[model samples]
Target: MNIKEKYEMSKKEYEKWGLDVDKILEELSRVKISIHCWQGDDVTGFEKTQNALSGGIAATGNYPGKARNGEELRKDLDKALSLIPGKHKVNLHAIYAETDGEVVERDQLKPEHFKKWVDWAKKNGLGLDFNPTIFSHPKAADGLTLSSPNKEIRDFWIRHCMASRSIGEYFGRELGQTCLTNIWIPDGYKDVPSDRMGPRKRLKESLDEIFSQKIDKKYNLDCVESKVFGLGAEAYTVGSSEFYISYAARNNIMSLMDTGHYHPTEVVSDKLSAMLLFNDKVALHVSRPVRWDSDHVILFDDEIKELSKEIVRNNALGRVIIGLDFFDASINRIAAWTIGSRNMIKSLLSAMLTPNDKLKELQDTGNFTERLALMEEFKTYPMGDIWNYYCEKNNVPVAEKWLDNVKDYERTELSKRS
Candidate 1:
């Protein structure tokens, strides 16, 4: 059967469940996820002098043909964007700035450093997001950036974050979309800490100093991400989930919840509804973790499906700022982006196709048996047909066929990186 015929057949099945297939697919296409830039370079930025990956962050394997400069990274992104379905934005770290071979410190950075990125984004009709790179710097050598005891170190990072917010504002103004500037610092102790309060207190003060000058939130949205533990900081983390959630609530900023930043059993899907109740907006860095924050490529698995269901069923798609955050240097980088992106979109579509209203009605009326039964029954629905149709409609490769293009690009473009 043809793709459209299969889609028509599947559409009948879902329409019986009270779903509008055409409307859902159109909504899915409009969803714009933010793709991270560091994945193309394995978190290695285009700094004149680079620092080793630290702060409990590391991208393994020596993948050849990693983006060596801003131009190469942008080209690689263009290739990946072509293969992935739906419109999306690009996320950039402060380290990805272009300095014309001059030494540009993080604290002294300006938007002009990222003019090339802004120009490329404008040409491609893509929005830009920003991140303050708190890791992989000498000042953060001890895995303490914003929460560092040293006043100089704290002040330096404060300045860097402030600069990042301004750059984010510039991106929003240039692209005509609100740019998200997310701050995630790696500051904690490996073993038991003697004075946790000291670090938290200092972190709050540093944040206060950095945000003292307010830029309009219309152009740039500010957010803080927290980690329960990191590679080096196992015992205790200064920016725990509790700390950031409280801070964001009081300061009126978004709190970024990274899927891989929490405990093993603690799922982020459960937090979305609660977060939406209190905050006007929230952000997410969708990632898969093997055990700890391992940052494996995102998979369309149970956890991801549940996460997407939360967003779709709760009608929080507009309020959630979605972004991808995983870098694997083992396989082909472009393929990594394509696979993860397609999976994320697929998860959202699956969530939309589910009979969420019926399920809620069952739960509200104490129909547990039917609720569980229908939920498991929908698992075998013709989702693949819908997904293939959506990909064909978007003019991207369907299913695993996108891998062929990735391999071709690897031979034609990446293999000749040297």
Candidate 2:
């Protein structure tokens, strides 16, 4: 039978278990996943530089057809968004600003620099998110930014972050929605440091100075991200997870958790409930990490399913800001975006389609054996039928047909990049 007929059959099966398939689809339609812009250019922003990547971050691989400029990057983003089904937003780094053939220092950046991006987002009917580019600059060559012992360096980064917040406010004010401005500095030592406390203290003061001016939260929400370690900062990272979580809780700001930012054994799914308990809202940088902080493209894997289940089970979708954060220059950039994005949406849909209420009831009534059995039985549900129907409803290609579109685009557009 067709997808609709199969979905109808699956819908009836779910109905018998006290689940509403249509309601789940409706909820999934409303979710807006923010796609990162850096994926198109392998984290290489529009800046005049000839140095290796700094800030404890590196983009591996040299796949051809990387976006050469802002126009091409936006064009690539447009193509990727067309294939994805739901409403979405674009996440931009400060370095992506369009400077009219003139050099603009990070500290001197103004909202006018990003006026083109705001206009583009408005035209495309997408929301905008912002981030301060603290790495890949001459000042960051020493692998320290906000936490630098050099007063000049610390002040420069502080001013840049503060300016970024203003730009974020501008995006929100112009677009009629709050913009999330996230701060993640790659400031740590490659070798063991005897003065870890000193650097952290400096970082705290710098953050306080950057946030001294209180912008309205409605226009711009501030978020701080923490990492366990970075390439050179493996021995010591000033902005550790513990520091940011405490700082965010104390300052009433949002804490962002990058899935690849922690130890391999630690998962963000288990941390969501704790974050929701303390903070009014939280943010996520969803990416796949293999062994280390290798920002591989996302897949519909076990951790992703569990992460989505946590969000659905707690009903915390409204409180969580979901955004993609990976750059794989080894494959077609547009395909990387589409595949990772679709898989993210698929995982969420799977979670929404689950009979969580029934399973919770089974557990609440102390029926452990039945709960395990029902959970396993849910693995066999006809999720593909519902997913295909969702794609059809959203006017996107269903099943594996999207691969054809990507291949055609590569042949006509991406192949011509060189």
Candidate 3:
């Protein structure tokens, strides 16, 4: 076929796909979106394993040293935050720096960097929150299961826990934000039947020791983000929703439910309900649920197309943070960030415009099939338009220039092909 014919044929195939650009725009309109830098950072040096160690240097998802210092980073963040919709502000999840990592910097909490973040937040009229995760020392990179029979490994784990708490205190004092930590121990049954109960006991003991320290009440209780499965035997935290929620509340802590971490067999709505009932702010990692790898990409609107309507019905809009958790070594970092941020914004917009009455009618009429079908309307919800809507509502500058830039680029590409 001629080049024109090939282009025509490709356009026909694209048309046959029936993807609604208008709907995509509408979905993008619904909510504001922000990204965690880790997923977007250049990882020139990343290490995944160190045998017999609990953890190694977490080099993945770290921002490259492109900027001179912390001030530059904060300034960049301020610019990003300013562009987002004023009515619905987006926050970033800090890098989940592990035990003995650079984030801990020689046991001297150099949180001037964090202070800079707060300054950026205030300068840009934004708020910040924390999602701290504990590290398993490289010495025990094999695992940090309380169930580990080795005393030395356990001691290392204890030291790590202390560090985490110390940092949490610093965060609370400096930022006036709760140290919203997500405790996911890389411990569970790896091979044969290890002492599963023993590990649970030890994990609790370590947690209790940290809480025992007289930190101010402003420091929120750590949210144990227990998963049904993970890296190894020590990785499995809470097995059931009831167990997970009850355990967190029982210990006077909150439970952060990861929407993607649940065993694929369970329904998303049930999990959403569990989070809605217990957690103050539902902090979830947005990622596509692939068969083998939970591809930490921005979750496609198609995946949560139906479940989101239910979430809207429950009115859990404010209590949500769109976390783009991914390992994007395969894609260009800038493109990955743009796509991930756009998709997350779109997913939220899909949820935001969902009619509460329509959702209620579905629930009230007991029409499960129809409820799922109704969600179809949200799939292509106009997102870019929503930015204007929020802008009008809040008297913020409409992103006309930004939108024009995107359209101009699209037109240029199309012209080139023509």
Candidate 4:
């Protein structure tokens, strides 16, 4: 038996106990999720995002090209605002300044640009999802490891942090909500060991400095999704699992779990512990995992097929804020992202609707023996209901009756568990 069989058995037991299957389906289906527009390649233009019929867009991108010429990016932003068809619009990325190597250019920052963004947010009622990447003059070739040893490099990084905080403060004052100044550092070790402990120390220091400037209000650092990787497994120094968690815990920062960041074969239990321990600090980066490759695939297949159920288990469900991490460099960026988002919502709905109270109960108890037993029972069970929910949610109506048959079968098998 495997997980599917166990779930089926549990679903049957739940139905017998009078669980409202439709309500469960509706609750799961109604869960709110949002994704960044940058995840897809075809997301370069504005028209593709402004959805009038469905939900408004969640976008994060480099300021429109006009901003570079000392021209206003906010005007383009205003134009984009007019394009959105819904009441809620979100900007998921922001960069205050650009820094590369030893050179830093702070003089070009027109405080007016900040004002423009805030004004736009007020008028359009948009939520900003800010990022602290590529905000300085010296471009990070190796990425912001936050552990650099050089004083120049360290100061450069700190400047970007300050700029991000300034923008957050402004947004907080105006919008009554602080922008989530999210960070995803590419800083890691490669090949040789270098003495950079002092510079590495600046990571927390910079963050603290920015946080301290807040005036009688609150803001969210939305835990940084750290990863440790290099071109050829030379040895990553930053964003590795251990370092990220430890640093986050020590610095009073939250943890946002990106499924693609973990070792592909990590056990579901371990993933649960990581999310639960950091539950209050948790935010999910919704994407599929394949062989340590964070390919932002359309998540309906083997990639995220079963793992999503594991996520909702162990009480890590409600804290989820889904997003697409698919890079634009992949396939038809637009179509892939649109389909991926649709599939992701469908997947969550399917998992949300599963009537496996027993399996959920077994998961909560933390008893290894029972867990193994449930896993065994899940092996041969046909979870056609799960498939049907997924299909129906995605508008494939033909699977409705097929799903009913599967649910009946599951209920029958579940009776044996008691």
Candidate 5:
């Protein structure tokens, strides 16, 4: 049957559970996913003295058509965003600064370095988010950043982070949206350390110094990210989940949870609900983890659906800031972005279309049998029909048709890149 016909049939099915499909679509449009910019360039920012991928993060594969500069990365994003439905914010790192061939040190970075990004964001009516890049730098060679025992190293990173907040403030002032400036450090030892407390103490002091400046919350929102462990720092990570969670709670800032940054058994889906219950606001980096903390593209899988469901059911949609964080250089960069971005939006739509209240009532009433049955049956619902209709309405391609656009771009635009 045609898309509209299928959608009408699906709408009737969902309406059986007292769902408003039209309202769901309207709600979906208002939620924005912050698409990561590094995915277009494999985390190789436009720094003059670029270093090898470090901090336990690596983007494998020598994709032939990776964007080499800021202009090309932005062009690639234009194509990806056009294919993906709705307007969203672009997440940028400190290393992505446009310094006009001048070697500007990270600690001394200013807002003018990102004037082009702000201008482009203004032209496209897209919001912007900032991240302080603490990995893959000379200072972080020992895999120790803020937690380093060396006073000079810790102080330098402190300045860089402080400078990063100023840039975030600029973005907010320019785009009229509060910029989320997230700090993620890769400071840990390869083996067991005798003095874990020392590093944690240093990290705490560095954070206090970085946040000492009282930037207005209207212009910039501060965030701290934590990790279970990483490549070089297998034994211990200074910014452990416990540390940041406590710090954020006490400091009244947002705590960021990256899906891939946690242990293998832990799922971010459950954490979302718990975080929402206690904190006023929490940020999420939606990424897939393969085996360990391997940053893989996000999929519309069971976990993501659960994650989205928590946000909707708990009424925490407005309290959470969602962003994508995965980089793979193995395939077409634009297509990677398209697949992940589309899946993120699709997963959220699926959750919104679900009969959450009915299932919750069943569970609360001790009707586990009916709850399980309905949950399983709901999986077979005709979400694709409604999705295709949403894409058509949004002026984007339906189903697999979007991939055709990516292929055309590869031949005409990406293939020409070095």
Candidate 6:
């Protein structure tokens, strides 16, 4: 049968379970998954620099057709967005600023540096998010920024972060949406530190200076991200999860949780509900981590499903800002974007289709057996049919059919990059 016919049958089946398929589809459609710009160019921004990726993060592989400039990156983004359904936003780092061939230091950046991006976002009906590029620079050669003990080095990063906030405000003002300006530093010690408090103190002071100039919350929101450890800085990290969560709580700002930033055994899904209780909002950098913070492409795994379920069950959809963060140059860049984004959407849809209320009722009443049975039964539900209908409604191809478009673009557009 056709998608519409199958959806009609699925709708009846879900209604028998007291679930509204229409409501699930409508809610899922409204979610805007902010696609990170770094994925398109494999985290290699347009900045004219010889510095390699520092700070615990690195994009592996030398895949051809990686965006070489802002124009090409945006072009790739447009192509990827066409195959993905939903009104989404684009996340940009400071290094992506188009300076028209002039050398503009990160600290010297202004809203003017990103006028082209704002214009492109406006033309595409997408909102924009911002991040301060604290790594991959000469200043960060020592594997420190913001938390750097050197006064001059600390001050330089502070200025850059402040400038990033201004640029974020400009994006929100121009695009008519609040731009999330997230700060994640790679400052840590490769070996055990003699004094851990010193770097944390310096990092806190740097943050205080950066947030000193307040922009209207209507146009811009601030967030700080934490990491347990990084590649070179394995022994100690200044911005640990405990540090930023407390800072964000006390300062009334948002905390960003990257899925890959924590230890392998710990999952962000378990922490979502608790965070929602204290903070007004939270942001997510969703990606799959193989061993550490490897930034692998997302898969439809158990963790992702649980994460989406927590967001949906807690009714934190509006309170949570979802964004994709991963770079895998080993495969087709456009396909990577499409696959990860589509899986993210699928996870959310799965969560929405779940009868959380009924399960909660059973659990609250101590009907453990029924709850377990119902949960297992849900696994066999017609989720694929509902998803196919969603894609059709969004004017995107159903199932693996979208791969055809990506292959065509690879041959016609990406192949000509050289």
- Tell me the tens digit of each residue's lDDT in model 4 across 1-418: 5434444564674366455555665565445444454442223322211222110112233221222211133433333223222223243443332232223343223234456456666876665555555322243544443545555666665565566656555566567765555666555555655644543466656555545554333743445665545343336445566655776677666666666666666633346555566546455566655555444555576445465676555445655554456543433233343456556655554455444576667678877687777556554343455545434443433232333433443344322322
Residue 12 error for model 2, in Å? 1.8
In model 1, the number of clashes is 0
Query: Which is superior by TM-score, 1 or 4?
Result: 1
Q: Which ten residues in a row have the lowest lDDT in candidate 6?
A: 48-57
Q: Considering every candidate listed, which one attains the maximal lDDT?
A: 1
Residue range 1-418, candidate 2, lDDT tens digits: 9888988987887788777889888888888888999999998887654346678777889888999888899989989998999888999998888888788898999999988888889998889999999998889999899999999999999999999999999999999879999999999999999998999999999999988977988899999999999998989999999999988888889999999999999999999988888877889999999999999999999999999998898898888999999999899899999999999999998888888888889999999999999888888888888899999899998988988998998888889988
Q: How does each model score on lDDT?
A: 0.94, 0.91, 0.49, 0.48, 0.92, 0.92
After TM-score superposition, what is the CA distance of residue 177 in candidate 3 from its true location, in Å?
4.5
TM-score of 2: 0.98
Write down the lDDT that model 3 would get.
0.49
Better of 2 and 3 by TM-score: 2
Clashing pairs in 5: none
Error of 6 at 368 (Å): 1.8
Q: All candidates' TM-scores?
A: 0.99, 0.98, 0.67, 0.64, 0.99, 0.99
- Candidate 5 lDDT (Cα, 0 to 1): 0.92
lDDT for each residue of candidate 1 in 1-418, tens digit (9 for 90 to 100)? 9999999999999999889999999999889999999889999998888899998987988778999999999999999999999889999999999999999999999999999999999999999999999999899998888998899999999999999999999999999999999999999999999998999999999988878868878899999999999988999999999999999898988899999999999999999999999988989999999998989999889999999999999998899999999999997899889989889999999999999999999999999999999999999999999999999999999888998899899999999997
TM-score of 5: 0.99
Which stretches of model 4 miss by more than 4 angstroms? Answer: 1-22, 40-91, 95-126, 135-137, 142-145, 169-178, 194-199, 215-219, 267-269, 302-307, 361-418
Give per-residue CA lDDT, model 3, range 1-418, as digits (tens).
5433443343333234354333534434454444555443332211222222232122234323222234433533333333444323323332323233243432233344356555655555544445433343354455554335676666555555555555555665655555454555556555655455666666666667656766565854366665565556433442334555677777766666555566776545566776677666665656555542255566446556545655555767656544555546454343454456555554555555555566568879999888777666544444445534444444433544444433453344322321
Model 1 bad stretches (over 4 Å): none
Worst 10 residues of 1 by lDDT: 209-218
Give the CA lDDT, 0 to 100, for residue 311 in model 2: 89
In the predicted model 1, the residue pairs found to clash are none
